[model samples]
Target: MRRMRVAAAMSVAALALAGCGSSTESTPGAGGASSSAKALKIGMAYDVGGRGDQSFNDAAAAGLDKAKKDLGVETKEATAVNGEPESAREERLQQLIDAGYKDVVAVGFAYAPSVKKVAAANPDAKISLIDSTDATGPNIVNLTFAEQQGSFLVGAAAALKSKTANIGFIGGVNTDLIKKFEAGYTAGAKAVKPAIKIQVKYLTQPPDFSGFGDPAKGKTAAEGMYQQGADVIYAAAGGSGGGLFTAATAAKKMAIGVDSDQALTAPPAARPYVITSMLKKVDVATFDFIKSLTEGKFVAGTKIYDLKANGVGYSTTGGQMDDIKAKLDAYKQQIIDGKIVVPAKP
Candidate 1:
């Protein structure tokens, strides 16, 4: 899906958006959840690794935490197990629904199928499916981010900071979802300096979500790139991203992190090497979705959160990225003005 373009650092005037790529109205969905359901009981189901993945799942957790503090909404959370049956997803969702939750969120691309099935079965429950821009369910509103847009910014940052003019990109699973990350990173780096070398690898192929959780494999993949003269590595490998940080520090190089600001969330030993992070703003989207429901304006459709909406951005913690801010801003403005359109595929 296409998104409305905006300056990467521009402030979003309104947090609640209705349509895809643009913010307007989150209208009450027709067939899914009962928007009028009493007492907001929200639940969120995380992808594998649950709370401590320190990447995607942690970002979503931030949203849930904010909802609890600001909205004072009662909430429940669950995580997936790798070897479980396909029915496992539906069962987790059903358990929450049975436990009196009227609103639930499924985090990750893998949840698209189960969210579709479960949301259809529970027509009166509001469901928010994160990561699938094209996800559609009877009572679900898809909360997706323009990851490519964010990836581009960090890619440019890597180019600016690289001493060897060589960087690497590591993805958890090789899919259209992660491809967006690779595509944007490559495009952004090239835009800054042609002939820059990018080493790309995925932890695993499709049907293997193990990529997101395997730090050992991640370390091996990133270390390979580091040995090849890559000075910076941008990793969108969820928990596996930790290995990228480790390798970067050991090699005396820089690293970029995904989802949350790894410069802050990463372990102290790995923090120094995290030059910056691509922030997905998942927490903002999640809280906004719940806000829509509570406000009686919940809309069910594919909503794309992108640079324009501040849905995707880069972290500036520890002043490590301070030097390259000007260059990053210029490229960001170019993308916003449509002078440069980051590709969704590589």
Candidate 2:
């Protein structure tokens, strides 16, 4: 499954290089639940931690919320459980589609196979997949992000704000996708301070995805890094990031967030330690997917959201990044202008 994800990303890169990163097509009479005569009904399948992770899944939920209010769409949502089998994911999606939900959004790469299988079985269903390009079909739309680019910015922020010049990264899972986060973070930090000391840890390996949802493991990993003289940490560990934030607060250190503006979404007690966040813009992709269906312009292909497309970005909600925003923005523009290339792997 993990290898498939990497290959899928490489395929997406090829598409981008070929000038086919994204394109709209009229799925004539293939609207499924997107009928123009009735309210659009959307079914959202979220990764672990659902709406309150204050990270990835929450970003998806925010899109759903906006669609509800702005588009007046009817919607239903479901979440995956830690360590569940792929069959479970398939069944969850099958249930949503069987219940007359013609438009379904699966919110993580773990659902790639399930989305492919379910969509193939249900020809009338319109499926939007977040975070992976492994699945493709007439009805399936893959929404992927340049997480490395955003992580690079926050990684630069960590290096710039680190008083000890020693920072850390905690990944929820040891996979190619999360490695992109590590790669960009490492490259960005080194770009700023060549001799900086950096520590890295992964909470779990594949088939044991609890790493993405386990706060206790995140806290333990972060505590160890902080004790080893790292003054700032960046967490790409979904719900586990909450634990990292807690650990940062206790250590009187700083931490970076991923997928959302966690300085504004993290638990109140841990907010102060969040210097900045890597914005993945899942909400924007989610809304755009639904909106396109409404406009009869549902695009059926891989869409890569990168620094150039404003799909990924950095957030400075708490003014902690005020001091160095200029430098970070400069780096961001360099990446956009192709003057600096952020690596997708470390």
Candidate 3:
């Protein structure tokens, strides 16, 4: 089973790379806009995992690719040093602005202060920060996702798929944002099976902020949960989730992934174990915002994309998920039809 899982993981990785390569080279922005016609220069800064973790960074890159192809925009990207200071992030943003990239998209909450400050300094530049709420300046747009709604669906799935009724949640940080995921997940699991057991763990407490990149901690947390008799686990720990997946695979248990389609992100041994993922449409949001810039319809201030807007939901593909797909679809439609209200905060 382990060897088969490894083979499957390798296949998924190859497919993902192929998908990325093909999509990235096609037209460069939305609608195949002419790059020669006053090319719009854009830059993006990634969060902890950088580009290849196959999660948030990759989703943002997908948006940039769409912008490049459809809108004919020139783009560049910068990586954050893992476990580094926020000052380094700020310096990179400044460098991008200084290099004449007028429109910038910073990919994580860690970039909030830097994005706000940089946007304030360069009034002419348009900046959008995803997964963060600190961009309140005139030139910056804050993009926040309704991750709770999607997490609710995945949580429900975890409850349904669990043979042991005991589940676990591992988070990157213990912030209100990450708590939103935990709260929704807990609520969703309870909604499905009121007696379900959930063991919650956080990779970091207050002030550390290393939770997102700490896979070692995530692995330890997952192993602890497994020892505690959790048969299914849900990870909202960014790069840390990779460790959780590894633990699940090793324990021969199941796990639920987050952010992007984690069924594709995790190693093969964890793929079949990953029943489904909370699909937060970061790529779509990024692409749409950049398209708005091209069409002169760029809206400033905070833009919230929730389940109702198709900006977030649960994944249905990647094998062994067909049985739960119908239920997920029904729940999704109910949410859209105003029959269900998924909470945004814990």
* Steric clash pairs (candidate 2): none
Q: What C-alpha lDDT do the candidate models reach, one value each?
A: 0.85, 0.90, 0.85
Ten-residue region with minimum lDDT total, candidate 2: 20-29
Give the alpha carbon lDDT tens digit for every residue of 1-346 in model 1.
1244454323353332223435223343443444445558898898888887777888889888898778767778999988778799889988999989768988987788888888888899989999884458657898888889899999989988888999999999998989999999998899888999999999998788889888888899999999999999999988889888888778878899898888887879888889899989988999999889879899998888888888999999989878889888888788788888899999
Model 3, which residues run further than 4 Å from truth?
Answer: 1-37, 82-88
lDDT of 1: 0.85
Ranking by TM-score: 2, 1, 3
Q: Compared with the true structure, what per-residue lDDT tens digits does model 2 show for residues 34-112? A: 5355888889999877888777888999999999888878788899987688899999999988876779999999899
What are the per-model numbers of colliding residue pairs?
Answer: 2, 0, 13
Give candidate 3's error at residue 20 in angstroms: 34
Best by lDDT: 2
